[model samples]
Target: MSFLPYALAAWLFFVGLYGIVTSRHFVHLVICLGVTQSSTYVLLLAIGYRTGKKAPIFTSGVPVKVGAVDPVVQALTLTDIVVGVTVAALLLALVIEIWKRAGTVDPDELRRNRT
Candidate 1:
């Protein structure tokens, strides 16, 4: 049962790779990037979950133990998510600008014009 999520995430990540390989449009590539980003998030969160661990909190009457998921990993995941979003947003913005200036988003066509 624990491996189910991992399997699904792997499958989704492969699909995203396929899209990136076969993409003919810039917008489709951006969508594929989003898909891959989500796949990593699912994988990371699944790996950090514990079967019986309580939430991370140190109350006066309750004690937090050593078996809880690492907060550092969680923080890294959050940072990765933010960075991915920033990259995707910047790429999309560049795509829009390229479309406005060149009137096309095809990478091959852009290369053609570079000559």
Candidate 2:
């Protein structure tokens, strides 16, 4: 197994984490969170990948004896993507509400303006 995908996933995770930690705006923080979650997709795909295997779709031409990539991993990745998008949408809505109330999207300013 190659280590490139794993390394790439780690790099993406760390970059997103750094962005989250340094984020000032609520929208930016949400975007960074999405970026962090995307690492899981790469990791899952890497884990399920086979060098020459076909997708887990069985057909008349493709016999069951022939190995296929894991379907569970692909399903999980799709689920993760859906959940991430949902969460990002919710967070964006919250940010919009916060901006309407406080006239600012900066987290630091929001904290200062808190009642």
Which candidate should be chosen as best, given TM-score against the real structure? 2
Stretches of model 1 off by over 4 angstroms after superposition: 65-67, 108-115
lDDT of each: 0.82, 0.92
Off by over 4 Å in 2: 60-62
TM-score of each: 0.81, 0.91
**What is the lDDT for 64 in model 2?**
82
The residue pairs in collision within model 1 are none
Q: Put down candidate 1 lDDT per residue, 68-91, tens digits, no spaces.
A: 764665776799899998999999
| Candidate 2 C-alpha lDDT tens digits along 1-115 | 8999999999989999999998999988999998899899999999999988889987788558768998999999999999999999999999999999889999888788875
- What TM-score should be assigned to candidate 2? 0.91
